[model samples]
Target: LESILANLSAGVLVFDRRFVLRTVNEGALTILADDFSGLLGEAPENWPRQLALGEAIRGAFAEHESSEWQEQIELEHTDGLPQILLLRGTQLPAGSHGGYVVVFDDVTRLIAAQRSAAWGEVARRLAHEIKNPLTPIQLSAERLQMKLADRVSGSDAEMLSRSTQTIIRQVEAMKRMVNDFSDYARLPAPELTAVDLNALISEVLGLYETSRATIALKLAAKLPPVCGDATQLRQIIHNLLRNAEDAQESVDSPSIEIRTRLADNLAEMIVTDHGPGFPPEIMARVLEPYVTTKARGTGLGLAIVKKIVDEHQGRIRINNRQPAGGGVVSIALPLASLPTRGHRVSQLPTEA
Candidate 1:
């Protein structure tokens, strides 16, 4: 069973008396971005995880009553990319050479999604609380200026009026930022239903698409109707597509692709483009609200998409389309179960 699972695309590692790998699965090798060729017949401590994994494993073993250790530890690869893994191990019985079992399940995407969602929440709450008093304050300042215009001397009136105007301008700026927060937080819960995902993509493409950027659709046929909120899902699709458009503005050939498919009892939505993909530096933080590559972007777009998908009890994924080319990202939603709402008579986003 372990051997079969190891052959799968999830990483697995085994350690022996000297902390050398006795076995490693294909998935683990892929994640390491290296085959076990040079790593085989080496001490577990000597393996790629020598410093971090070795110390963690040794500590867990010594501290445990039994030879089992289970934890979520973060490891940074030589590429400087971080891999979050849930590490689990168990000691074989006596005479088993004190060997241990280990597994590494990558949770980088999960953690990114969580961080994005959290920041979005914080921004939303801040905006909601600030908006209430802002409107009245601005109104009162304006009214005071109007009433005092004729009562005060010209010199004093001019200074007081300018001060009030400055206050009003600053308050408006603060309101706008709060509005961004409100937008991030106010995506109402999705009301999911059975609907044609391809149609949804087509409708959204025709609606919010920009003449400034080329939009491509390569939707799959023979797929099952997706179970999700048409309106909210469309919003998600709209936001992601717009984001792709914004990313492509920097490329000479800006093209966007939208695709749909079903896999492992889940429905999938993939958006690809012929532009620069996510920045290598901030890929880990891109989903977090206020984390944007654009000079003027609010950076809450992806964060909103993530929250909507999570509300539907589905999963989403983002990746650079292989071949080291342009931008390519994906979103996946599980459709094994039926949704709980009626068809939505809805609309899409305006042109960007």
Candidate 2:
């Protein structure tokens, strides 16, 4: 029984009727990513809030009639991504030594997969529905402009031209938008190769030497190469840099920082901007398609970045920098030929 508990992926915790933790299996310790020394005799209330079972344990004890209860909770990690845990709590029989048993497993990937699928379907439908008529609309506007050019005179001719130009321009913009949707819906699988991430960032930075925002780089001297598609990786750098530039539009002394380092056998890149951080309400869903805080944003930039990262088996995290203010985006990719350790399969949830 002990060996089985030790090997199980689901976390298991046994608490006495008094709410003091009694027995915790190895699976529990691994899932919580915490040490057992502090958890053995601690009550739910005394457990670290980020790792605590919270109301699930207490609610199970209170609902005596029900044999089992289930809940989903989000655990916030100050230095890492938030974890979504699905927990099931069962009340011990009255005849047995009374207590509650809680079993939980990380379900963050499952939830993310569901969201990705839903959004992909939405993108496909939007592209198919909106893209079909864009060319006809643009061509019709151009035809009207040419046909009316000889008939109208003076200011009337100018008005006709302006109206037709406006129609053409707006139609072109819509076509681009629809193309973005199509790209997101059917992004190609990346062709894997060894990529020098730092070199790629440097190359992308060359295009921004005259950018309004001052860009700085702090690349590691001995960072290892990562396995990724060079072209897609370049797109990721471009998207992040553009985001940082847009974020600095309102700042008097706009500055952006890009840093790269090696950690946990992964090549990690961090991009920071000195702009107002993500709004509180939309931070959680910021990575979702068509969700944006920018007035002119298509909101597909980050979504595509996420899709590419997911394909490369990497992780991305977004957060607001505290005390100093601004926003930070971090991407971590596995080192070439090195398996990622202590990393989950999904992107980290945004932190605010």
Candidate 3:
């Protein structure tokens, strides 16, 4: 039984009727992402509130007559990423001395996959529906402006010109929004190859030398190459840098830091800004499409970045920096095993 519990991916915890934790499996420790030394043999009330496990155990103890209780709870981790856990609790059979058993599994990735797919479908439909009329709208406004150019005089003429120009400009903005939707919906698969991550970052940073934000780099001396498409990877860097700059818009001396390191056979890159961190309301769903805090932001930048990183089989984490108020975005990609011949870098147009 112990071997089976140890090997199972689902976490299991046993507690007596008094609600003191008695047995916890290896899976529980890993899923919780913390040390349980002081938690063992402790009552639920005494356990940390952040774990949220205590609530599940208490509920089970309160309703021992019920068949089972199940719930999904979000746990904030030390690393800043919140984990979604599916927990189930049940009362142990009366014959074996009354106790309760709580079981849980990490379902963060599964939920994220579902949300991404749903948003992608929405983006596809929006692109198809909204993009068709944009060109005609812009053209009609231009035609009206030209035809009325000679008919109206003085202030009336100015009014006509202004109205038409406003129409044209708004149409152009809508067109841009539709394009973003299309890009998010139909992002291409990354062409995997052995490419130096540090080199690519340096190349992207060159474009931002004159940016309003003071950019700094702490790239590792000899970071290994990662398997990714150069063009798509460049987009990731561009988007992050743009976001960092936007975050520090109100600061007297805006600053951005970019760092790279190798860990656990993965190439990790981190971008941080010295600005007010993500607002509390939207931090959890910041990666979701159209969830943005910027007044002029389409909110698709991070969503598209998430999609690209997903295509490369990479991982991303967003959190606010401690002590100093700012935001941190971390991305980790699997290191390429072998070097590629004739590595190619593709240049593609970037959005503002």
- Model 1, which residues run further than 4 Å from truth? 1-41, 48-73, 76-81, 86-117, 151-162, 208-210, 335-352
Best by TM-score: 3
In model 2, the runs with Cα more than 4 Å from the true position are 36-52, 60-64, 78-80, 133-171, 222-224, 278-283, 320-322, 335-352
Give lDDT tens digits, candidate 2, residues 158-179.
9999999999999888888888
Point out the worst 10-residue segment of candidate 2 by lDDT: 343-352
Candidate numbers, best lDDT first, in rank order: 3, 2, 1
Clashing pairs in 2: none
Provide the overall lDDT of each model, using Cα atoms, as 2-decimal numbers. 0.74, 0.83, 0.86
Instruction: Give per-residue CA lDDT, model 3, range 36-124, as digits (tens).
Output: 88888998878874346686568655775647888788887656667898988888777788888889999988998999999999999
For every candidate, C-alpha RMSD to the true structure in Å: 7.2, 6.3, 5.6
Residue by residue across 35-94, what tens digits does model 1's lDDT show?
667567786466564467667766777788465678887777655557787777787776
Winning candidate number (lDDT): 3
CA shift at 276, candidate 1, in angstroms?
1.5
Candidate achieving higher TM-score, 2 or 3: 3
Q: Which residues of candidate 3, in runs, are more than 4 Å off?
A: 49-51, 60-65, 135-168, 338-352
Candidate 2 CA-lDDT value: 0.83
TM-score for each model: 0.70, 0.78, 0.83
